[model samples]
Target chain A: MTKVTMTVNGKSVSAEVEGRTLLSAFLREGLALTGTHIGCDTTQCGACTVHVDGKAVKSCAVFALDVEGADVRTIEGMANADGSLSVIQQSFQDHHGLQCGFCTPGMVMASAALLADNPKPTEAEVRHHLEGNICRCTGYHNIVKAVLAASGQDVPAVAAE
Target chain B: MFNFDFVKPSSIADAVAAMAQTGAQALSGGQTLTPTMKQRLASPSVLVSLTGIAEMKGVCLGADGLSIGGATTHATVAAEAGAYYPALADLAANIGDPMVRNRGTIGGSVANNDPAACYPSAVLASGATVVTNKRKIAADDYFVGMFSTALDEGEFITGVTFPVPEKAAYVKFNQPASRFALTGVFVAKYASGVRVAVTGASNNGVFRWAEAEAALSANFSASAVEGLTVSAADLITDLHGTAAYRANLVKVLTKRAVAGAK
Candidate 1:
């Protein structure tokens, strides 16, 4: 077993886990931060996306031990200090960005990272940034809308092609 | 994934020493290695994490060329290398998604040499040097075959140095599901000559397209290779595309790349 220590969602936490334990497993099973869903065990789906050291990554594709001493942020920490939805989260709700909502957490995390990096991304850029996150409900139309709206861009009533 | 011992080495010397142990492997970004381990395809007894080594993690442009640390993530390269080499930066920006790019490393991508990876094309066309803890290998001599390299056991890459090209561009047709290249072409025009490397479409992995290279070297235009055709025998044929189809894509992407090169 390996002893891993890191800050998750603004809290300092440490755990003894197997060397092969994935960051997703550490966050979901060990820390009980189930907000970071694991839709696809493979890296193909970004359902387990989280921020490590301020950059978003697929939690399933990273080992917990490899993240020692790093700061990790998950979907659970995206709320305001008053415990209300953050801008991105509120945008998703207002835009009806999700249906089944299985992939919403990952989608929200990935969108937050994109806007942090590119504050004003184009429609094509927003669509491209979501390539890793798979939404089986085919609700990408509104997901894109929410991401764009969160970035303070005007969302067209009719989704642009 | 199976249980194993994990060791984070803070220096290149220590990393090399750790990897020298039996059943040990160097872990950079863990983008490919982690997924492979989860699938039980790889089960090394020891994982020597290289990210802790601060020396192996930056982008520096010098008289030699653009030197990028082996452990530097693709996102870092995309952001920092843009000022010097836009082609390399653009290719890095499109490697995976925002999440994958955040974790995937250039060294990991080149070392894995996935047929569909984007870095191999950039490394090959730019004629970069793979600098390992032991020695430097030219790009032409570094790539052996698909998912294989000239890197010796216990040896780990420290960084890769790319020479500035007179003009270059990378164009890829991504396979929708994985976002890996169905057919990608990188064209680099230098003062000495021209180089055209194709990835994802080759059975032998990333390789220089000599016919296209010669034509582009002579004319440096899309129309120069308009009549050229690549043999389908050595191209990859799978669910994504037939060998003949890939051969056609090679020609088309090369034309587009040349037309788009600065």
Candidate 2:
């Protein structure tokens, strides 16, 4: 077992985990921060996305031991000090971005990272940036709208086809 | 994943020493290796984390070319290499996603040598050199085949040096599912000659298309190889595409790359 220490959700946390322990597992099981979901287990699905050192990454694809002394931010940390939803999360709700909600945490995390990098992204850029984050529910129409809206862009409502 | 000892070494020498242990594997970024381990595909006895090593990180551009440290993440390359090598920056920026690029290192990618990986195409086409703890291996000699490299056991890749070319461009047809290149081409024009390396479409891994290179050398334009056909004999054929289809992509991508190169 490896003893690892890291800053998670603005708190210094330590855990004794096996070498095979994934960061997603550590966050969910060890620290009881189950907000970070693991959908596909494989790297293709972005359902396990989180931020490490201010960059979004798949927590399932990283070992807990490898992240020693690193800074990790999850969906749980994205709330305001008063426990309100962050702007991106609120935008998702306003845009009806989620249906099943399995992929929302990862989608929101990935979208937040994108907006952090590119504050004003075009619709095409938003779509391209979300290639890794797959949302089967809502057909991704609302998710794209939510990301764009969170970035302070005026997103038009989707017209019924 | 099997049980393994974890060691984070702050120095390359310590990391190499840790690797000397039986069944030890170096971990950088954990983008690829971690997944392999999670699936129980790789059962290493020890994981020597290279992320802690400060010496093997950063981008350095010099007279020789751009020297990228072994542990330098893809995001770093995408953000910093833009001023020096915009084509490389473009390729780096598009790899995986925001998260993969955040953690995946160029050294790990080249060392792992996945055939569909975008960096091998750029490295081979740019005629970069893979600098190791012991010696340097040219890009031509570095990659052997799919998931293969010339790196010996315990021989660490400190970084790679890419010689800035006169003009270079990388274009890839992304495989929808994994976002890996179905057929990627990197076309570079140097003072010496032209080098065109094709990745994700060949059975032997990333290789130089001599025919395209020679054609572009004669006339540096996309239309130069309009009639040139790629042979399907050595192309890769899987569920994604047939060998013949990949051959077509090779020619088409090469033309587009040449036209796109500035």
Candidate 3:
């Protein structure tokens, strides 16, 4: 086993996970941040999307040991301190972006990630950015709309180094 | 997932030492490995992570050519190295979404050598040299078969030196699920000769279409491949496509790739 120390959801958490323990596993099991989901194991279906060192990645495809000293944020940590949804999260609700809610949290996180990078993405750019995160429901029309709505408003930028 | 011991070595020596153990797997970007673990396809006894060992991380343009460190992620490859190897940069840039590209390492893709993998075609056609712990492998001899390489039991590629071709291009038909190439062609013209390599089409893994290459060698034009016929027996038949279809695509994509070569 390897011991990894990382900041997740702004909390420093450490775990002695096995070689096979994925970051998704670490978040769900070690830190109890279960917002990250695992839809597919082959890096398909970005249900396990999360932010590592402020860059979005599929947590399932990332080994926890790889991020030993990095910072990670899951869908659970996307809200403000007062428990209100982040701007992107609110936009998803307002635009009816999700259905069945299975892919919502990851979608929200990915949207937040995209809007953070390209605050004004063309429709094609938004489609390309969300390619990793698969939404079986709504055919992604509303999800694209939600992201466009969020992109109109300034989403919080990751802490600039 | 089945449990396995994990070790992060600080030095390249230790990293190589860790590979000496039995059933030990070297982890690069985890773009491929972790998923294999989750699917129970692989359960190595030990995973020697190459991330912390800073020695294997950098992109440098040297006298030899463009060399990308094994642990360099695809995003950086897309952003940084793409300027030098524009065609390769295009391949890296279009790999998956930004997240996969952020973590997916070129070495991981090259080492894994998935049949339809994009980098291998570029690496092969560019006449890249795969530097491993044991010895250097020419791209031609490196990829043996599907998901196979010339690496020995404990051998792993440390880096790759892709000779900047005069012109090169990678054109891929995506499987869409994992975004791997269903049929991809990487065509490159080097100082010696124009090399044509195809991935995701052959049954015995990546192979050079000697007929198309011979035709293109004579005349590097779209019309050159229009007259030739690729043998279907050389290609793979699967859910995505048939041997005949893949054979046909190899020609179509090759012409497109050669035209797109820059």
Candidate 4:
């Protein structure tokens, strides 16, 4: 077992885990923070997305030990200290960004990063930026809407599922 | 994933030393490796992860060229090296979703030598050097065959040394599910010659399209590749594409890439 230490959300987390333990595994298994989901083994799905050292990444593709001294952010930590939703979260909820919701957390994480960087992304930019996160339900009309809303803009329509 | 002794060495030297032992796999960006592991394709006894090694990070622009650390994520290259290596930067930035780009390392992509990958073609076309613990292999000499490299066991790539070119472009047709290329053409012009490296289309893995390269070498023009015909012989045929389709894509993508570069 290796001693893995890193900051989760805003809190420092340390755990003893196997070397084969992926970051998703550590978050879901060791830390019991199951908000990050693993939907595919081939790295195609963004369902396991999280932030490592401030950049959004797939938790399933990362090893727990890889982030020893790094800072990681997950879906569970996206809320304020008082337990209210963050701006991105509120936008997602208000715009009906989820249906099955399996891909919600990862989509939210990826979109949050995108909006943080490019606050007012165009529809093409939104489509291009969020290409990594795939959803099988509700198409992407509302997801795009959520992103636009988070950017403090009007919602988008006609993004067929 | 197979069971293994996992070790994340805190430094490059330690990572190298750890890989020096028998039956060890050096994990750079686990984007490729971990998936292979989870799928039971690779069952290494020891995993020497480079995540802890600070030396294998960053994108440094140099007087001669760009030297991206082995551990530098694709996102970093796509985000940082835009002015210098537009083809690579765009390809890296857009390879997978934001998640894969954040974790997938250029080193891992090059070392894994995925036949349908985007970076191999860029590395070969740009004449990048695979800087390793053992030796510096030229782009042509580094790639051996399918999922193979000149890198011997225990040898780890320190970083990739790429010389900036006069102009370059990479165009790929991706497999929707895996996001790997169905066929990718990376074209570049150097003082020596014009290089047209074709990945996703060779039984020999990544190879130079001689006919296409010769044409481009003469003029470095899109019209140079306009009439060239790529042979289907020796190109890979798999579920993603037929050998014939790939051969045709080699020519088509090459033309498109050249045009895109212009």
Output the number of the DockQ-best candidate: 1
Model 2 CA deviation exceeding 4 Å by range: A157-161
| Model 2 interface RMSD over true interface Cα atoms | 1.1
Cα lDDT tens digits for candidate 1, B1-262: 7888999999998998899999999898888888898888999999999888999999999887999999999999999999999899999999888888888898889989998899999999989999999999999999999999999998888999999898899999999898899999999999989999999998789999999999989999999999999999999989878999999999999999999997
Order the candidate numbers by TM-score, best to worst: 1, 2, 4, 3
Error of 2 at B214 (Å): 1.1
lDDT of 2 by residue, B226-252 (tens): 989999998899999999999999999
Model 4, C-alpha of B255: deviation from truth (Å) = 1.1
Question: Residue A40 CA error for candidate 3 (Å)?
Answer: 3.0
Which portions of model 3 show Cα errors greater than 4 Å? Answer: A153-161
Number of clashes in every candidate structure?
A: 0, 1, 0, 2
- Stretches of candidate 1 above 4 Å error? A159-161
List model 4 lDDT by residue over B140-254, tens digit each.
8999999999998788888898898878889889887777888889988888888989988898789998888888888877788888788898988888779999988988888
Inter-residue clash pairs, candidate 3: none
lDDT of 2 by residue, A72-142 (tens): 99999999999999999999999888999999999999999999889999888998899889887745888
Q: What DockQ score does model 3 reach against the true complex?
A: 0.65
Residue A95 lDDT (model 4):
84
Weakest lDDT window of 10 consecutive positions for candidate 4 chain B: B93-102
The model with the greater TM-score, 2 or 3, is: 2
Q: Which stretches of candidate 4 lie over 4 Å from their true place?
A: A159-161
